[model samples]
Structure formats: structure tokens, C-alpha cells
Target: MTKILTTQNAQITTAAVEVKTLTISGKQVTLSVFRQLREEPLLTEDVTLNGVPWGYVNYHPDKCGNHRRHLHVVWQRGADLLRSTVYAPEVAKFQSVWAKLFIEAAIAEGLTKRSAESFGISKIQIWPHWATHPHLAEFSYGGVSFQAAIREDFADAYDNNYVSPYVKEKAVAITGPHGDAGSIAALKLPVAEYLAVWDALTALPHLFIAV
Candidate 1:
């Protein structure tokens, strides 16, 4: 549709209407290079576009200009427009202060659109996979860094049988700081899910039974 085009600095001086996204680099943080902040579990902070508190950014073609365009994504915060312009002299500097607009940046710059939704935002400079993930939420519960993983998580393993034998055995193994992983939650399960687990476990013996 017909949309107003703005400069990467948020200025309305641009005559072209194609969509483009501006990126800023934020503090360096740990994360998977292949995923966005909403798709990786290694980041921990909040970044916004203009003023919108967005989990990620996206790009689209502009309708006002023949070949001219601007970024189409919004800030993660609530506002639709930025109060001030964000200036980045060097691409690397911008890459260090704000999260990179993955697929959108390329599209804005006339690149590939194969990964528009896969772009990333920064939480401590790294990409994450979900909104309520470790970075967005407080990592420490009582007094832990939240990266704690241990080996005892394997004790409660089971066979789901919903898929192939190997696939059914797939499970979660979250653990604490040391190898002394906490025991399985002894608490009761919801009626339906509990029954489901029981049924799956029941089939285990027979499937594994000696012939």
C-alpha cells in the first residue's frame, strides 16, 4: 500500500517508499550466531525499534517509491515512531549497539528475503528464540546464573512411543550447577497428561520385553 517513507535516521525526507530497516549494535552478549534473539536461549537484555518494544523486526517493499525504500519494522516498545534519530557512522558500530534486522535489512538493502521472520533483536547483544526466554526474563531464581546444567537429568528418561523408538525416547534433562541434578518433581501431574504418561510408560516394558 501507499506508506510514508523515512530515512534510516527516522526522517521523512526520503522520496522513495520502499521499506528499509536500520540496525544498531548493542552490548556484546552470548548467543547462537544462526538464530535471532527470539530463537536462541543465550541472550539477556531488551532492545526496541524507534520506541516499540519488539521481540524482532521485519521488512517489506514500499509502495511510495519506484526503487527507494526504508525499513518497515517497529521498535519493541509501545510507540510507533522514534522520538529521536539513531545515527550509525560505521556498520560495525551499529552492529555493536543494537540488534541486527536479519531478513529485513537484506530486503531493505535489496538483498534476500528468504529469512524475513528469522531476523534477530538483542538482549545483551545476543539472539534469543522466545519472548519469555532467559534473556528477557530474570535468569537468576534464588541465586543462580540460570545456565546450570548437569548429567543426573538422564535418570527420569522414558519412551514416548509417539514416534519412532529413538524419537519417543527424546526428553528434557534440565539440571543444576553440579552433577547432583535435582530429582524428578514428585508432585502429581494433571489428570489427563498423567494418564498419558502412564499409558506410555506401560507400553515401555512390553516393547522392551525379552522375546
Candidate 2:
């Protein structure tokens, strides 16, 4: 099943200003916007298949052709890289040029069609497995509550006004409504391991039985 998920910064309420994300089962398509005071917000977009990188569109002022605005795409896994025509950084231009075409490209490239059953849901709602911290998402799965909190690796950078995308690492603990991490099995892993951990936790029902 295909699902579309979107999010915005905590202080922002308008949909026009929010980052848009689209997913088809475990596949992810991210459209990120950087707000600008004097022009259209710059955008970076990527499509990932089964948690692996696939295609992207971004602006690099130093690159040749169209002043560095173009789509960098991979047609299939283990396939050659393909570049599309240069595009404007505006959101509307991106939607017109890359959005539907990338979906077609992914289909032609043999992307998997995942079943809904392969995905799980938390008590609150269905959570996107690929989403990371700083998004303020909280959910429970396999009788364990999970919260996506900001990882500390980027703390100093954030304090100094520098930001890095490689900062998300999973830190998980099992607890009740008001329990702390002190009395639980707390551990940290990257996003891949975190998903595996939850799968294992949910599959092992015998371990959850009380003595």
C-alpha cells in the first residue's frame, strides 16, 4: 500500500512552509525546503527504495549546467547514474519536473512492492520506519514505547549554528507511561538496527509472557 506522510517544524503551522515526505510502504521520498528571505525556498529531494538511496534532486551553485540545479538519479539498483535537465529551485518547478517522473523511474527500475503486513503500527498511529529524531514522533510497538529524541552527536554543532544530516542514531528503552530509562533495557543503534530490534521484539511473543 502507498502512503503519504508529511511534517512541519513545531513553530510552523502552514502546509505551504512544511517539508513534504512521500512513501510507498518502506520506500521513502523526501522533499526538503530551506526557507529564504529574498527568493523561493531552495529544495532538496531524494527517493529511497527499501531504506537504500536511489535518486535525488538538489542545487549546487558550483556545478556546471543550469547553474547546478538538476536531478541526480539512479535508474535501478546497480545501474548507471542519469542526469536530467536543469530545473529551478522553486517547489512548483520541482513538482512539475521530478515528482511523477521519479515514481515512474522507480517502477521501471523494479522497485519492490511491499505488502501492508510487512509494516507495523504503534498505539498512537502507524509510524514511518525510516523517520528519525527531531521530528517529535512518539509511538509504542511490541509493548514497548519508543520516542525519537535528538541524538547528542550534533549538540555542539547545533549550539554553534552548524547542522549536519548524519546525526541520527537510535536510542531506545522499554518503559511504561511514566517510567524512566534507568530501569529498562536501554540501547543505541543506527536506524537499521533499530528497525531490526523492533521486529525481533514483536516476533518473540513468548518473551513477553509473565511468569
Candidate 3:
């Protein structure tokens, strides 16, 4: 037996892990904690404005064996990748404190521009947590319209027809903006599933609406 010397065998034991997203000017900054790792906890974060990458950080444990925790930085530096070494005995505690400081540093970098709404987002509507409703955001990409709305069914009395309740509670739908079925690629996905897709889309050069 080789004993399988790998960090993948570890597990995360945190009570709660929440994703914190910030909208500064028109840019979007996301802060997420991964306290579920078996060996150590880390913060995975990124920042984008106008569909452009301002900064990003990701933890790679397998490369350094949890001693010299490797934090990868994603930004234009003429190179594909670069890393910074973080040596902290108390890995979990260090990551929690580091996340806050990193956010401050990102704000000071002066990357946040105006609001995404102010730029060129007319069709999509973005609703934050503070708002009465919790619709994340909705917009069209390449003529494929997408919307994040409450996952409820129509009530009785709409032409005397009752719609069936959704099997999964919350979800989003992708369709054509104005009933163009020919070129429309309609899809409905749970909020959790769709949000991940939205996050990946933000990495593109002009896809992220910034709202």
C-alpha cells in the first residue's frame, strides 16, 4: 500500500460556509471561505469590473503539503500564473483574518469603477440581499435571456388552469428575450446550480454585466 499521501483524503469540518459578494462602483468582488478542508481552511476570492479581471486568489494545498500554503493570484502580469507563500501555524485562524485584510487591499487598489447598471445594463435587473426580494440578477447572453426569479407556480384562475408546483423549490430560467423560439436555448436550473454558471461567466471579457 502506497498510503495515498494526498490532501484530497482530508475533509472540511466547518459549521458554516457563506459566500460574500460585494459590488463596488460597478465592479463585483466575491469572498468565500472554505473551512471544510481536512487539513486547513482557506479563503477563495476574486474581483472583476466591466467583465475584466482585477484580481483573484485561490488556495492550492496539494502543491505545498499544507506547510507553505500556496495562494495563487490571477491578474495580468505577462505570465500565466503566480503564487504567494503563506506560512501560518494556525491555518484556519490565519485565513479568516487574511480574508478581511485582502478585501481592504483590493479596495485601495482603485479598481472599482462606476456601477454596472450605470454602464450598459438595461435589460437585466440585479437585486441584492438588502432588497425586499432576493432575485440575484437576470440578463441575456448571446441572445439567450436568463432570469433569476422566485420558483413559484401560477395560481388557479389564469384561464381556469392551475399549474403544477416545481419539484425543486428555487431556480432560474434561460430563454430568448422576446419569445424567439427558433434561436432560444431554454433551460431551468436551481439557484445554486445557476449561480455557479453565472460566476464562471463573469470571467469572460465582456459577458459579465457588472450589475
Candidate 4:
């Protein structure tokens, strides 16, 4: 017998693995929940612009490196790509809710098949954690304290949208420390509550382009 777990916005079917179904914009979409960490995407769909193949939208969970255990989206077009974090890594459940919001954001940005290049909007800022991080100076580890100059440099790079020429090298310089401080946790919300927030965000006119 297949067991069903119901949430406020989705139904998850449990078996050897879990699969969730959700209703977004009156359409049913399915998402898979992995029993173990997998390198592959949980879901993927093609994105087109003006009837031309623009790229693919990939939904990844527990991805490696910076995206570890985070439910996120990767917008890919050959070598060029952009990534968006839909939900924080610490919120381990409600993968389907995050996926739904990702799709909805894509739709709101007019990245759908029928949309043209002129219809594509700038990237959405779903949450603060998606873009910002705590300053590095607050933590010290391995007897290595981040110097004031280093902290100022990092702040400058961050202020410049992380595009400083020495940003990568500066980041590498601080990689040895393992500190327990300066961690910020994302707010965990129930499926329905998160959806409501997402709805309000999508309603902003600047997030969409008129084609």
C-alpha cells in the first residue's frame, strides 16, 4: 500500500522513495524527494524564448559545494548559466513547495516558451540569504583572526556585487578557518505561508517584463 503524507499545499506519496505532487497556477506538477544525496537534478524542464531553445531550468537538491543540501534552480544555456536559491539548505522538507515557487518565479519573469527575449526580466531576489552572507570578520578559527584590512576588502567586494578582481584570491586566503560563529539560519515557513509570501513577491510589477 502506498502511504500519503499531506501538507497544506502538497501531497507526498511515500514508498522506497518519496514523490510529491503540487498544484501551482491550476497545474499539477510532480517533484521527487531523494532518499539519499544525489548528484542529478530532482526535476528539469526546457526553457524556450520566441520558439527558440533558450536553455534548461534544472531543480537541484543537495547539490555539492556552495549549493549543498539547498533546493535551488539552475538556468543553463550551454556554457553560460545562472543559479537561484529557492530555499535554504537547513529546511529539509517541502521540496515541492520550493520547486513550485521556482516555476512560478520563472513564469512571472516571462521566461516561458511563448515569451520573447524582450520579455525576460532580471533575476528575482527570493530571499536575503540568496544574496547576502554574514561578514567574515566576526569569526576566528585556527588562531587566525581576519584582519581589519581583510574585512574591509571583503566589504568592498561585497558592496561591488562580488566583482572585485581580487575577490577570489581573498576568498581563498580565508578558506582554512573553521569557526563556530557568524552563522545565520534562514526562516523556515510552512508550505502555505511560504506560498503566500511568494504570491506577494510575484505581484510586484517590476519583477515582470511587458512583451
Error of 1 at 208 (Å): 52
**TM-score for candidate 4, residues paired by index:** 0.17
TM-score of each: 0.13, 0.15, 0.18, 0.17
lDDT ranking, high to low? 4, 3, 2, 1
Q: Which pairs clash (backbone N, Cα, C closer than 3 Å) in model 3?
A: 11-38, 12-36, 12-37, 25-114, 26-114, 26-115, 26-116
What residue pairs clash in candidate 2, if any at all? none
The TM-score, computed over Cα atoms with residue i paired to residue i, of candidate 3 is: 0.18
Local accuracy of candidate 1 as per-residue lDDT tens digits, 1-211: 7776666535545586543223335422222211232222111222122233222222222232542221222223332222111211111112211122121111222221232223211211212325434221111111111121111211111111122322222221122222111121111112233233223322322111011
> Quick one: ranking by TM-score, best first?
3, 4, 2, 1
Over 1-211, each residue of candidate 3 has an lDDT whose tens digit, in order, gives 7677579886778788544432345555333222121231112322111222333334443444535332332322233222233222222122222222222221222212232233222243334434534333343323223333321121111112322333111111222123222222222112233334345533423211122
Question: Residue 45: error of model 4 in Å?
Answer: 32
Q: Each candidate: what lDDT?
A: 0.22, 0.28, 0.29, 0.30
Model 2 TM-score on a 0 to 1 scale? 0.15
By lDDT, the best candidate is 4
Evaluate model 1: give its lDDT: 0.22
The clash number for model 2 is: 0
